[model samples]
Target: MKSEVALLQYSDASLKPPLSPLFIHNDPSSNIEDHPSLSNLNITQQQEQVQQFLKDDWLPITESRNGNAYYAAFHILNSNIGFQLLMLPPAFLTLGWAWASVCLLSAFVWQLYTIFLLVKLHESVPGIRHSRYLFLAITAFGKRLGKVATLFPVIYLSGGTCVMLIITGGGTMKLLFNTLCENKFNAHSLSGAQWFLVFTCVAILIAQLPNLNSMAAISFIGAVTAISYCTLFWTLSVKKGKASGLSYTTSLSKDHSAVAKITDILNAIGTIVLAFRGHNVLLEIQGTLPSNLKETSKETMRRGVTISYILIAMCIFPLAIIGFWAYGNQIHGGLLTAFPLFHRHQITKFSMGAIYVLIIIHCLSSYQVYAMLVFDNLEIKYTSIKNKRCPRLMRTCFRVLFGGLTLFIAVTFPFLPSLSTLLGGMTLVPITYAYPCFMWLAINKPCAKGVVWWFNFALGCLGLLLAALLVVAAVRTLAITGLKANFFKP
Candidate 1:
């Protein structure tokens, strides 16, 4: 098979001018003989060097590539907006509205900075252009260390996230069933494990939909559902606050000990970090951009990041403030769960039901977004088919098996909140915060005394520290509560 550079060379002859002229040597007018690097090479060696340079500098231009800014924005929105958004209310309960907002904004800026670093690194390093996270790691850190850094985190994040999605989807399905059935079918009648199996089957079907671009419609709907449910949640929480006559308060509870408060605040920070953790798949989304269009990739990334931040700020702050004002310490895992008081109202029940449906849909769609990453990696590693698409039968069988594995894991460990926090600290912190900064530092080699270099270095250290603390906090919480091994337990 020809290298991507070779393919681009072929296409360049037929379509547009070569991308080499745009990136090669950063001096188009300078003769190859004038450049010290190429001047020493013979003609054949010089030609090969130029080809290698082009391959390193730009992603291959494909005629079939069709994504634009809107699709890219929706892709980010779908990936970022998941069941965790609903957990913002509980996060706010721990941190209070003021501190929660501050943390949320800080996380947003931190994520944006890291994302910019990753994109700039991709552009700056010729060898890593259009590469996945793993390849980027290998290019920067060498094979052994790169595989160690990339494989474990990517698997842990993608695979663990898929399992969490199953748990959340199953739990939400159970809630909807109980509500609609009027308690006729309680937790005993249909177990959460069984519902997980059911959703896993559903995801198995969705997983066979081919590729990421094919799921754009589902992603668009998922984004809309996320926005709608977040709006409805904020509205209901505000209504509850008005009825309860409690003002939005930023004060921490005096009843809790200082240690407990600090732990809760750290847990809240972990949850927020998890909510913002979609950087793992940014490169995949970036790949969808038309490779020939100059700056389109960067612009698409900017638009997507802007849209995500705006939506997060709009949804999270209001829900946090109102939900905390109304429920205080009573708030639990999700804002939706904090609606028991309003359940008596028909409108509230209807809204909750709709929100549950939306959550289920969001989970299903977002599951594919992450699961695809895992599938792609696995297929490349295990399958005989390389360069060409995997056969339909092989794809279906692989997905079915993968789905079963995820289902088993979800049933075995059904603790969504704790699992999410663990994944955030262990997988997401590195992927979102540390790795990009480290990669930028390695690839760009910014000035030692420059602000950018020190800023990223500080952020990397902070990310490591934050991950360690959050992991410790999550483990401690689990130990104190004792692990619930019974899958049938309500």
Candidate 2:
């Protein structure tokens, strides 16, 4: 590759002439000897050497090849928007959700910092392979600490898959059971034998999900739906306020009346934290983009982050305050249930249906990405004959299993809130707060001078504290309540 690069540069005459002028025309033998024009070429070569040295030494090497910017941007938007959807409803309601969001957002900021740090660290160490810097901690601690250390990645991958399956099967079933069966209590009342069959099918199906790239491409359309839904909320809120000829207080959820101010604060804090989980998607996005267009990757991520925050702040804050005040705490997942109250008198039922369908699709796309990431982490691969990537029999079996499994969960255990809470508390919390801080510490980045480093140190400490708190909360909830939740005080 290096030789090819040099050859490509040599081909550019505009860049520099390789042959000396004295050796031109008839004297071929003179070409083998040093000529006066060769001195100029020598000078150019020296300058080029200096420039190359600086570029190679000081900068992170970007790929020479480039691809379409639009496609790259679309890729980023798709994955990130899924994180955004995963964040929204949780951000408006749950206490822990706010913490989760903050952890995620912090992780995103840290990811950007890590890229810069990795480059700076690489530049600081001379004559070192980039992989040495990249994986030194992994090699030192991971390879040498014991056979136990080798299990971390395997554990992470396996745990990830399990979390994904649990959430999808649980969330989908919850949505289906509530929407179709209209059963509130005893939602998962299947017999023991029936439960066994249900889980077996779900396990097989979730084990055979798609890759990150495919999910990102498909999610772009769903993100547009999310944007539209936000628009619908804003337009309808104002119209409803005008029609009622009442104050903003009237539009708030009424069930929240009996709740204490501290609970509201806690809930808001949790919601804010959960809203920040958009960071995790950025890591995968950064790697996926063509390495040649480094600047565009940064800009694409920045735009996505900025847009996500602005959209959520505008759409969710008022929605939460209004939904909680008007309907009270009875609002089940803000996007699904809370919207109708704000525009109950204005939009037709058909319009509501359109919004519902859009939300479901958006949710499914986001859920699929989460599941895919989890499965991929597990090193699970499934092939499709349409792409001739996997064997035909396996692909057919995989699809049939997944579909049947989803349907089983849909029929048996349809409880979205509990599933989200459990999954968010267990997997999302650790992935966001615990892992980033641990990874940072693992890298052993020497603390720099002054207040900036101290601030980061403090932030890392806070993340650890929050992570510990979440673990305790999750454990307590599981012990006392089992898997069932009573989010409503009643």
Index of the highest-TM-score prediction: 1
Predicted structure 2: lDDT: 0.40
Candidate 1: stretches off by over 4 Å: 1-64, 126-128, 185-189, 243-261, 293-296, 346-348, 382-388, 487-490
Deviation in angstroms for 395 in model 1?
1.7
- The TM-score obtained by model 2 is 0.55
Evaluate candidate 2 by giving its C-alpha RMSD to the native, one decimal. 13.2
Q: Mind giving the per-residue lDDT tens digits that candidate 2 earns over 127-241?
A: 2222221133332245344224323433332333333444443443444434444455565655333433454454444334344444444556656765666556545654554
Compute each candidate's TM-score over C-alphas.
Answer: 0.82, 0.55
Per-candidate Cα lDDT values, in order, are 0.68, 0.40
| Residue 232 accuracy (lDDT) in model 1 | 82
lDDT of 1 by residue, 374-471 (tens): 76665554322242345667767777888998888888777655566766788888889888888888777889859989988899889889988898
